[model samples]
Target: PTAPVAAAAAALCVLAVSPGQAWAASADGPDGPAAYETAEGAKPVKGTAGSGDGPEISPGTYTDSIGRGEKKYYHVDLDAKSSAFISAVAAPEPGSRVKGVGEGLKIRLETVDGSECDGGTEPQFSAEGAAYPVADYATRLIGADDECQKAGAYLFSVEREGPETSDPGRWPLELRYMSEPGLKGGPRLLPGSPDSDEEPGDDETPAPVTSGEKRQAHGGTGFNDAGALAKGVWRDRIKPGETRFYRVPVDWGQRLNASVELGSANSPGEYPPTIYDGFGITAYNPARGRFEDDPFVSYTPDESAQAAVYTPTVDYTSRFDYSTNTPCLAGWHYLAVTVSPQLGKFFKSTAPLTLRVDVTGTAKAGPKYAGDAHAAGFGVSDEDKEQAEKGQNAAEGERSDSLRIVAYVGIGAGVVLILGLAVWTLTARRRAEALPGAPGTPGALGGPAGPGGQAGPDGGSGTV
Candidate 1:
């Protein structure tokens, strides 16, 4: 074969064998759906069946898979001075069937003595009957209660459950452990004050921002890669049985208003056109805690469906309020939009989605922490705002980008190696051809014998 052909073949073989390159090619293809992007350097750990007997998890992200009716446990070491938090995000594989409502994951934190830290959060599937990513966290607060306050070693347990007939595949989980430093002056509840003295009167609805031009924004499959958006209108597409995540930086004293509008779809021409409450939007606080329940809409193929959610102004005191946890912290609040899997029966293609976000109220100073709250993913920063404005994925982090770069360099090196091999082979062939006894020459090695012998196509010895 020619040198160029050999070099091309070698390069193709390298790319074909490279997992990262193959995955990247498929993921970027037109028909491929986006999969959840786990945290960079996320250690894969197996959770034990028994509490405190599992592997130890530190202040970082980890990945695992849990089956239904099974409990997975991991332990974390903590200091009594700083508050500790462990959040679990469970996502079913795309196209997996779910029982809806009661089917979901449960998370809890407890001391070795079996003292439960918090009430433990259970994030379940809604009435959508579709599988999407759901997350909740268990925290060991610094001075909230007397129980589990002195943190030496605590167990974090995750339980998955669903209906008897639901899909039995194991769901992938993303676990995060965070340590929030103690306050400078110790934990103290701040007095509650209304963000605005004059509240909007009853029956008054605030207008959404519609003046800005819509920019393209693709949402992430999970919180770890959630797309960042500021106060603007963004455009994206979502397929049936898919959920997309976007995060907005909410500073202290700021209130967030967001809505998602689904484009109209072709009617299936059934009597009393089917009505679905499966399309909706959900909100979560910085800790991956569910604060706002989904406000679902009766969706019909003939018309557009819109679901909106408004959050209270973010304040330090909001954490103490049990009435509503919408404004619990001033950080990157997540918005999750989902479409039911059942919709696939009627609409085979992805539907267009428009998102409108408005962040109101002036940003106020945040509380003082003994350690950096931003490092713990609690507070917003100028960099966060800039990233949102540029439509970057805030959760992708620098490590993920570095990994991608390394993969690209590996492919490049493979190509260079192929070229070098091709050059050496071509040079050796030229040197052989210049020799007196070259293989293809009439009087040379492997050449035809004198006059009566027939030569091969290249003047080498015939194979007859």
Candidate 2:
């Protein structure tokens, strides 16, 4: 998963945001108004500049390992003073000018195995651990963490506080960026499709596993539910004994065919499978709506065999989706989900119903997609595959509790053995007191317990 990423060559030229011509009286000039933190999204600051963990450039857009792949992230921050009410700052496109207008300000990332890899939520760098903005990074700061595997470019968009009244040029951001891998992508999806893309859940099977160096993680899912978002919607419903497939939308970045394991099992061994993408159905608020057009694509990385298990409810559930990370080449045609054998059979309805179509790009209007029908990757040995699955299944439902149980059982058995040894020692002492004196009790206590748990102390007792 070591993808070679290209830096702008010049750090200053990387961002294409334009300095606006308009500004409030006090918030005028290129070095306009000092920012203020209203009790909003990302607290706005009144000043810029400080010292803190700086932003880092990642190696690749994605990576892989163990039960999963594409396991890296990035960390960036800045020490600056501002005067506008800054909500959460957006990660914009590579060189977009209009920032903070909710346009081009999206933080999108995915995994190598097509799981929705996430960045740290509410992770920060500032003067204090408390949620406070850095007045300046030359001394104080503001920051967030991104995934850190292979290299990739991150785009951020900006938005100033207020009801679209003041110009953004009035606020100055003294940003400092840094890179850290110890952060997190949090927890992501299982390998296979478990529900309608509308309502993703845990009761599904685990995806395939990984080998070589396995990474240890301690983060949870950061399902971005901020702003106006629709949590549930119906994707595709499978009737009894019916099966449907999907095509991954990689935008042609894939070398081979892409595929997602789809099913409708009540549990792992259950049957009547179905996989569908309901990403198009989910809605977002205006502030975060610009990214709504980006279809969730599975970013598959190089890995051995792996599978995800989960339960699919009638509602939709979304998994390994899209990412604006640099790994996604602009204009490449990626595949989404396609119903195989035949589109969903309507046991309840016969006439073909038109499904609403959309695209990650605003220009193109096409059928909503998910993953591909073909499997792609380096095959895994059966033995290694099994171990990886054990981890994946546990991870999907947040079931590390089972691992805890196993550890306690081992400890319990060890305690039992120790107690048994103590009991045996005491029994031998009592026997000696009762009648086993060396001279008089020779026949009575010749052996306590031999290898076979028989006879006396010295060895097995016999007529001798």
* C-alpha TM-scores of all predictions: 0.76, 0.24
Candidate 1 residue runs with Cα over 4 Å from true position: 1-33, 189-205, 270-272, 325-327, 395-464
Candidate 2 weakest ten by summed lDDT: 133-142
List the RMSD of every prediction in angstroms: 11.9, 24.7
Identify the candidate with maximal lDDT.
1
Error of 1 at 155 (Å): 1.4
TM value for model 1: 0.76
List model 2 lDDT by residue over 232-343, tens digit each.
1113332211112211122121111111223322222334233222111111111111111222222111211112211122111121232321111112111122112112
**Residue 300, candidate 1: how far off, in angstroms?**
0.4
